[model samples]
Target: MRVTLSLFLAAGLAAIAQPTLAETLSFTLDNQTPNMIVQFHATPADGGTRTELLKKKGLYGGQSRKLTIADGSDACVYKIRAVFEDDSFYDVRDEIDFCENDTYTLAD
Candidate 1:
């Protein structure tokens, strides 16, 4: 009975030590405009803080990129904003259900 108790405790400890899976949102970004996208912001639809999508890189014209956001928030909808190299802003919409959409395209 002692050996069985020890094994059960060990199994319980091992399960407790396992890390939880991180939640993340992923989508593809398509740049169809003639300008280069210098900045990308993904803000929650609930008026919370915003997240920067670009990882120190620019999305050139006609380029496609896969973006992942793991802001530790339970927000499924976000307001998308993209800034071009020409200092122009591109707002995709008021708010988008990023969890439902897999691809977001920016066009002229």
Candidate 2:
């Protein structure tokens, strides 16, 4: 009985120690506006610092860039920000679902 209890306790501790794996989401970003998209950022929908996706590159008008992001949690939701070369920024306002959505477009 003691051996069985120890086995059960070990199993319970192992289960508790397991960490939640992050989910990866990939989608296409389309630029329809006339200005060039200079910077792009994504962050947890709840509240977190934005991480740049462009890697010091820029997306021009009529161009599309594929982006891949790992969700910190299972929600798969993120806040997207796009800055243009014309000194303007676009805020998605926290409604983007990177998991379910196939594409995000920036327009005038």
Candidate 3:
């Protein structure tokens, strides 16, 4: 009985040590001109292979939308950018660190 109890406690501790899955990264852009297009990217080290995960037009005036970042990708910094229909652009290209179970949340 003692041996079985020890094994059960060890299994429980191992499960608790595991990290929880992180939430997806998100951002919002508001007041965009109608009919304009937006773009976002997840930048990483080695200066190679940037992913474009979202592309959509302005849905409403003074609105906010959340950006999505995929799970289980290469580890490195991340950033996002936007491009309007009229060739105008806005970029948020900051080297933000990301952990396997870390998440970022933006407001307004």
Each model's Cα RMSD: 5.0, 2.1, 7.6
Runs off by more than 4 Å, candidate 2: 1-5, 71-73
> lDDT of candidate 3?
0.54
Clashes of 2: 0
Ranked candidates, highest TM-score first: 2, 1, 3
- Give the number of the best model, judged by TM-score: 2
User: Where is model 2 poorest over a 10-residue stretch in terms of lDDT?
Assistant: 68-77
Q: Which structure is stronger by lDDT: 1 or 2?
A: 1
Residue-level error in angstroms, candidate 1, position 44: 0.4
In model 1, which regions exceed 4 Å deviation?
1-22
Q: Could you give candidate 2's per-residue lDDT for residues 7-77 as a string of tens digits?
A: 99999999999997877778898999888899888887877656788877899999999987754555577
Report the C-alpha lDDT of model 3 over 1-108, residue by residue, as the tens digit. 999999999999999998876445544434444544455456654464566645554434345565556544545466645555566665654566654324433222
Clashes of each: 0, 0, 0
Which candidate do you rate higher for TM-score, 2 or 3?
A: 2
- Cα error, residue 81 of model 2, in Å, equals 0.8
Candidate 1 structure quality by residue, lDDT tens digits, 1-108: 999999999999999998766459999999999999998999888877788999769999999999988887778899989998888897876688878998988889
Q: Candidate 3: lDDT of 24?
A: 56
- Superposed model 3: Cα runs more than 4 Å off: 1-24, 27-37, 57-61, 71-76, 97-108
